[model samples]
Structure formats: structure tokens, C-alpha cells
Target: MKEKKWLRTVLSFASECRMKMILSVICAMISVAGGIVPYIGVYQVIILFLDGKPMTNGIVFRASILFWAFICLAGYITKLVFYAISTMLAHFSAYSILENMRNRMADRLMKAPLGTVLDQPVGKLKSVIVDRVETIELPLAHLIPEGISNLLLPIGVFAYLMFIDWRMALAAVVTVPVSAVMMAFGMRTFNKKYAEYMESSNYVNSVIVEYVEGIEVIKAFNQSTTSYEKFQKAIASFKDYTLHWFRSTWKLMNFNGAVLPSTLLGTMPMGMVLYINGSLSVAELTMCLILSLGIVAPLTSFTVFVNDVKAIEYAVKDADDFLNLKELENQSEQITLHRFDIEFDNVSFSYDADKADSPNYKENSALCDVNLKLSQGTFAALVGPSGSGKSTVARLIARFWDVGRGKIKIGGVNIKKLPLAQLADMVSFVTQDNFLFNCSLMENIRLGNPKASDEEVIKAAKAACCDEFIRNLDNGYNTTAGEAGGKLSGGEKQRIAIARAILKNAPIVILDEATAFTDPENEDKLQKSIASLTKGKTLLVIAHRLSTIKNADRIIVMEKGRIAKTGTHKELLKGCSLYKDMWEAHIGAKQWAAGSEKGAVKQYA
Candidate 1:
């Protein structure tokens, strides 16, 4: 994952497009050869003019001049053609790799433990999907091909130089190694700084996204100073990092820019003095001078390519980390459900053990040795205190995370044996924070089933009580939801989420406080819709308000990652101490709400 890996990886990609790559190399050679020969042609014309007689006969001199002219003309034309092909190859390869990468990353996210994604900040995940992957284009497409072409030019020039005069060639060769050593030293510093720079950019992006998303909350709290301070901090950090990088990079550039070309510059005067002192002939001097200039393009190109190769190496290292991440092992099998019933058998899990460096958390079990069975076509409620693992139970039922011990079975089949897509089709969940795309309402709703008909979408909307609000809007179903549906009320967005779940028609539905945001007026309709949808389907509801689960077929009360009690509402109220206490507290709140001047308490269940 260090710098320099990029060139090796990119070369692998180029190797796949072997023919185009070979053609590019050939074009580079032809272009360099033509450019170098012009000086020799000029030198020959000068000798003829000075001596007032040609070295060869008139026809032969004319033919030689024509031959050089043809070399220059053909070289220029071939260079353009080869460069075009090289660019196209790079473009095609980059775009192809990017396209596949995006698709694979999306698939990985889909299969990733849902709780893992929930735990991460939305802005950070957004940065990964949109910014991090997009940044790879530059090094992959432009740097790889151009870098190789530049490398070849230098090697070609050196070979031609050695052929003409080894002593002067040795002078040029010796200077390159020295310049390379200096460039390498500079690169070491630049690489570390560049890594820091990229990290700062990602942080700034995350902060900016958070600021924009929470603008309303900031304004409502009258926290403009706090918000501005955050923005100022992020921007200042980014600026400092960028400035440091530029300053360091400028020094590196100065060294590389000066040292490479200075090799030929220093060699030129010495070669000319040798010719004048009769140690070399005029033709030989002409060849040396001409070839030295020829070496300039390739030699300078080699230096630039060195830097580019290092950059690409770092990029490849990053990409390899992404590619090396382990996907679910048994992901390809088709999903099979013998029955919709779900069972958790002595399952135990702890998040800390798996992480490389456990963050701030005491050794608390997320789930203990819990056993439960959820029969098909029944409405079951999981009631618990905040850390009682009710959400963990729901997540396990959906196979969001594999159990640390024992097994989770859908019907009689282990969830691990099921195909991911098939498992997805069998279950639907509407979480507390409903996510919506920045797209038209219709499009967002259609995510439940991309090929769903407009009629089906309208039907689903009606089922979730979303049709009225949607119709009242000026754009109707065409209205944009804004980012994550920020433009809509929480209730409106939740109903849309429910509508999506309904449209999906999965056999099992998990609601993580689905009605928490709904007002009383909409609550009745939504509750009835949910009840109707649960008919002959497995339903698991997580609730804070006891009233919401009063009518559920069964309720399980959980405490400290273990089940406290399980029974009907009346049974729990009579037999379970914790349940009775929770119910009493809830009843007290309801009475207090009835007595209050503000009217009915806005209870969230």
C-alpha cells in the first residue's frame, strides 16, 4: 500500500491491453528517433555550405537531404497517431476499471453488516462512495501511459548517445543517476506530505457536508458562532495542509527541473571544445551535439515520469487495500426459505474482539446467549431498555451481522446458506432514520422494485398513507425529495419508507419504531396499514411506547442483552415486574399528558 505500487498495478492493467501498449512504445521510439536526427541533418548542410563542396556527389547530397526531411515529417505524424492511441487506451482502461469498482463497492456496501453502516457517520460514508473512488481517475488514466512513454524516450536517447560517443554518453549517464538520487530523496518527503494532504481534504469534505446537512438545526438552536467556528477550523486545516504541500513540492520541482536538463547543457560546451581542438571531427561533433539535444526530451521526460510513477504507486497501494477487503464467503448461493419462521439459538456476540484497536467501550456484550423463535404470519414486539439488544435481535433476524455463536435460521435453513439477494427479497426493514435519495419521489419509491409500475407505486403510497401529502404537493410524485429527503417532514419521509417496504412485499418486515414521527391524525391510518400488511407475514416491531405493542400477538421484554420476560400484554403486566414498572411509567405519562394544558402527549413508540 505504499507509494510505487501504482506503477506496478497500472502496468498490470496495461498488460491487459497489450497490443495498444506495444503500439504506443513503437510510436514513442519513432518520434524520438526523428527528433534527434534533425540536428545531424543541420550539421551536414552546414559542412556543405562551409566547404563550398559536398561530401558526396550532387544527387546523393540531394537524396540525403530528402531522407532527413522524410524522417522529420514521418516522425511528427507517427507521434501524433501513437499519442492518440495511448491516450485512448488509458481512457478506456480507467473508465472501465472505475465502472467496475463503483459497482463492486456498491455491492459490498449492500452486503456489509447493516449495523456497521448505521454506526458510521453518513458524511464519512458519502465521502467514500463519491469522493475517494472518483479521485483514482487522474493517476490511472493520464499518469500511467504518459509515464511509460516518457521512460522509453530516455532509454532510446541513451542508446543512440552510446553509439555516437561512449565518453560523452557516460557523462550524460552519470548525471542522471545523481539527479535520480536527489529526486528520490525529495519524493520521500513529498509522499508523506501528500498522504497528509489527502487525509485533510477528506476531513474537510466530511465537515462541510455535515455543516450543510445540519443548517436547520444550527439555525434553530441559534448556534451560528458554533457552526461558523466548525467551518473555519475545517477550512483553515485544509489550507495549511495544501500550502505546506505546495511549498515542499515546489522545492522538489526546482531540483528535478534543473538537474535533468543541466546534464546535456554541461556536456555541450565540452564536446564543442574537443571538436575545435581536433580530438573530434566536425561530423562527429555534429552527431554529438544533435544527439545531446535529442536526449533532452527523453531525459527530462524520465525525471517527470519518475515522479508520476511514484504517485501512481501510492494510488495503487490504496486501491489494493480496497480490493483486498474480504467479501461474504458464501455469497453466491441462491436463497431458499423452507418457512418464514426465524430462530436464534444460543447466539452470543461482542463487537470489541474483532476490531484491531477497540475504541472507547467497556467489555459489554451486544448480544448474549439468547434463544427465540418468531413464527411466520405473527406480529411480535420486542420491548427493552436502550441497551437491552432489541435492535440487535432485529438485525440478526435480517442477517445484518453473523452470530458469534450458535445459528440464525430462516425456516430450517441457516441464514448463512442463503443467497444474499434471495435473503434481501424475503425481508424488509424501515429504520428510525428513513433514507431517501436526492431524486424525484416516484424514483425514490421505485427503489423497492425498480421495474414496478406507476400504478403499483401509487397503490403502495396509498397503503402507507403517503398519497394525500404527495398529491397536495405542486409536483405530485415528481417532486424532488432533496438530499436524504430533507425537504420533507419526518412523518412524510417515514411513510415513504413504509411505502417502499410495502411495495417490496417481503415475507418478513422489521419496524424499528416505524411510527415514532407520525402525528395522531396520520398514526391511525398508518397503524391500520401496517396491521393489514402484516397479515400472513412475519412481523417484528421495536417500540418505546408500550401502547403501540398492546395489541401485538406476543411481547418480549429484554434487559441487559437478555430476555426479561415474554407474554401477552395482560400476562406481562401481571407476571413481569420490569414490564409492569415500564407500563406504569407509560400510563403515568399518558395521564400527565391528558392533564397538561398542551393536550395529548406526543408519545413516540
Candidate 2:
């Protein structure tokens, strides 16, 4: 049943190039026929040379040597030409279909929720997209149409031999069962082994990436020995597993290889015996030997594709798994909106919503029975300890993940009713660890609003206080971010991210630790700029520094995934013990920094 399903899936991909694949198969069959016809001519020519009589039904070779040679040469040329045409057609169609599958996978990801993409590891996803997808090319390009012909050409030769003598034909294929047993032994463990191999490869890739990304921290902490050992261990594990997997199958494979092409082993002796008897002629025995040798190459070629069948099945199944990930459902793109107020109506959520659909899913709620509202054009602040669901609240507002229960409305309509693109346009989320592409600063900022002009990008950058440092750089706005903004300081990346959000100018701006990297020197200016940019817009700023949001119209205190308090900063301090303790801690930390700075100044003086 699984084999049948795999064929259906492969045929579905082939249906896109059905005509091309059909033509290619036809050409391959013709190529094989062309090869067989020349073998017949060669056989007749041999008989003419030895028996002094025409072995063919006509006076073909006896008439002229040059004509027979020309016929053989033409036959070989036709075989070569049609084989080349078939290969070209097969490869062209295969790659085209592969490209389409990749595009469809990309589309599926775009339609999926952000949480769906985030939950998967970077290495695993990369493996599926780049490595696993490429594996399909082997079977699609070579094994489908060409492999069919490879199988048929040998079968055709065997049929002709059977017509000549059933005993010789049986002898020709006598070693097949032994070779088959060897092949089966070698490949019996391939599926499970290959899956493990892929898993190890993906782990190595992920470990390498992690090592490279954290190299600076590794050096700074002087933990090079341990970290490098971890890195080496991952690679070593993958290498050891791969070598063992290969070693386990290598001996049987060698035996199979030794036996598979030995078609002449039985045919030669059997034909000689038959010739000794009155049953076989010298010409017929010679023809049988020659034709049996001819099938060795085809038989070898056909068996080569047997291993590929498993690889193709695994590759196609992995690709299909990624492409079939459940998409986030939305009602329509044309959701009606009157205002941009954000509302959480008895909302609850969990990060593992993907697994939560299962009956065995445990309840690990990130937020539960929490309800809040941000009126239009209000400046609200979300404050909490680490993992208190502050970021989750902001993420929910941006529709990064759907609420497991209850409704989140934007402008009186459920946010789930808005398509991803429309929802993205409504919210501008700027986080501390926002990604920067390896491109010019102008282009990076313009990613927020792709159609934004150069001048507008500069304006937004200036507004976000990125213009001064940007201008001092060698290329100014033209400077490349250099691999996740490695060329700039953390503060600079933050400012650029804010500039992107500013350029977007969405009505709902959620700054999730957007100012975490800003130094004390520029924090006030950046805050002012942010305040100015978000004027008359619904602003939800999540911050650890309470001083920055002291003047916010509302300060929401979250504790253990529930709203503990909501008021102005002073009201919170007066009424909420948790808020009061957090404010006191913030002040103490600030005073400690001030004291340390003063002590350093005195020591320097």
C-alpha cells in the first residue's frame, strides 16, 4: 500500500510533465530497439563470415560488406541520438517539477502560522528544503523513464534468447537469484539506516551552525575546549554512524556486484554443451554468447536503480510532510474595521498548539483566562518578570500564533478573520533580536515597506536616530549589514530595526524590548523619537526598564500568565505589591549602576 501511495505521489508530480515524460519513455524504448536490431545484424554478419551462408532471411550482409557495416553504424548512431534526446527530456521535466514542488513548499510555509515555522529546528528545515528535495532528482530524472528502458532492454534481450533456446535463456539468468539475495541482504537495512544517517547529518549541521554563531561567546568565556569538543563530537558521531552504515552493507554489495553481471557464466558452458549435441548450431551458440554478454551492461544498469527507490521514497515523503503542514486558517482578507483598538477577550493560549490538537496533549498554557483592551491611540505598557507571558501577549496581538481559546479582535473584528498579509500591515513588531539581512542598510530598512523610496527610508532612519552613526560609516546607508548586522553594534541594529518599523508606519506598534540595547546616553532621545513616531497610534511597549514607561497611559502588570494589575505607573505602585516590588528593584539596579560609575570616575581621577 505504501509503495502504491509513493507511485501515486510520484505520478502526480510527473503529471505536470506528462507529455514530455511519455515522449521521453517512447524515445528510450526506440533507443533500446535500435540497439537490439544492430545486435541481430552483427549476428547475421558473424554467420555469414563462418557458415558461408546468409543467416538472416535476406541476402543482407552477403550482398555488400560496406552496406552491412553502414547499417550497423546507423543503428548505433540512432541509439545514441534517441538516448541523448530521452535523457534531455527526462532531466528537463524532472528539474522543472522539482522547482515547482519547492515553490509550493515555500507557499505552504508562508501560509502557515509563525509558530509552526519557529517550532521546527533550522537544520531540519534546511535539510528538507535543500538536501532532501535534491534527492528526488535522481529517481525523477534517471530512474523513472530511463530506468524503465534499462529494465526493458535486458528483458528484450532475454526474450530474444528465449525464442532462440529456452535452455540457453535459463542459463543466462541462472545467477540472478543469488545476486538478488545478495542485493536484498545489502538493502534490507537501508531504509532505517538512511533515516538515521539523515538525522545525524541534520544534527551535525545544526551543531556547526550553533558553534559558528556562538564563537564570540565561546572565546569570551574561555570555554573553547568544552564548546569545541561538543562541536567535534557532533561531527564525529555523524561520521562514525555513516561509516558503520556503509561498512555493514559493503560486503554483500560487493558480492552482488560480482555476481550480477556474470550473465555469461551459465550461457557459455550451456551453449557449448548444446553445440556438442545436435541441438545447437555454431552460429546460434555464438549468437547466444554474444547476446548474453550484451545484457550484462543493461542488467547492471537496471539493478543500480533498485537502491534509489528507497531514497526517492524517503525524499518524497519528507518533502510531502513539510508541504502538508497545516496552514493557519483565516476567514477572509476583506475584514471590516472601524478602529485599530487591540482587544483580548477572555483569551488563552499555548505555544505547543500544534501538538495540543492531539488527545494525548498536556495542558501547558502560556496564558489563561486573561483579558485586556488597548483603546485606539493609547500608549500602554506591558511589564512582567521573565516568562510571565508579556512577549506572548504582544505576539498574540501580532497574530504570530492563534489563541487556543477566546478571540483577539482588532477594530471590532476577530484578528483570525484577517489574512496574514493584512494582519502584518496592521501591526509593526520590533524586537530586540530582530534579524537583519546581509544587504545594504537602505535595502534592509526598506524590507519593512518594500516600495518605500530612498528618501523616505532616510527620513525614517533619521527619525529613529540611526542617521548620525549611519552617515559616519564608510558607505552610509549603502553599507551592508554583513551577516545579521555583524558590521554594526547591538544598539545600531536596534535603531535600524526601529527605523524599519517607523518606515512601515503601521497603526498598531508593539515594541517588544526594542530599546533594550540603547545606551543611557541615547535612550531618552530614542524613546522620544519612538513616542513621536507612535503618536495617535495604539502603542504597546514591553520593557524591563520601568522608568521609560512611567508616563504611559496604562501599565499592565502580568504575573504567571494572568493580569495581576492595570493602571498608571503610580497607581500600580500604590495598589499592586508585585508592581511595587518590581519598581523598587528597577530603582535599586539603576542606583547600583550610578554608584559603580561614580566609583570608577573617582578611581580614574
lDDT of candidate 2 over 268-385, digit per residue (tens): 8898899998788888898898888877776777556766777777777878887788888865647757799988999878887765565543347788788899999888899999
List the global CA lDDT of all models. 0.72, 0.82
Among all windows of 10 consecutive residues in model 1, the one with the lowest summed lDDT is 596-605
- Per-model TM-score versus the true fold: 0.85, 0.88
Give candidate 2's error at residue 36 in angstroms. Answer: 2.1
Note each model's CA RMSD in angstroms: 4.4, 5.0
- Per-residue lDDT over 1-605 for candidate 1, one digit per residue giving the tens place of the 0 to 100 score: 64345556545544456665556455555554544455555656656655644554777767766776776567666666666666776667666666665666667666666655567676655555556556666666665456655666666666766776776676666567777788778777666676777678768987888789899999999997999899999999899878877786787678777776676665577677777787767766666666666555666765555554555555455455444444554568685556898888887766543742344222456877788888887888999788889988888777777776778888878888987778888998888799999999998899988989999999999987789999999999999999889999888898899889888999998988887787766677677557555657788899887788887788999998888899989999999999999989888887776332222212211
The candidate maximizing TM-score is: 2
- How many angstroms is residue 136 displaced in model 2 relative to the true structure, after the best TM-score fit? 2.6
In terms of lDDT, the poorest run of 10 residues in model 2 is 596-605
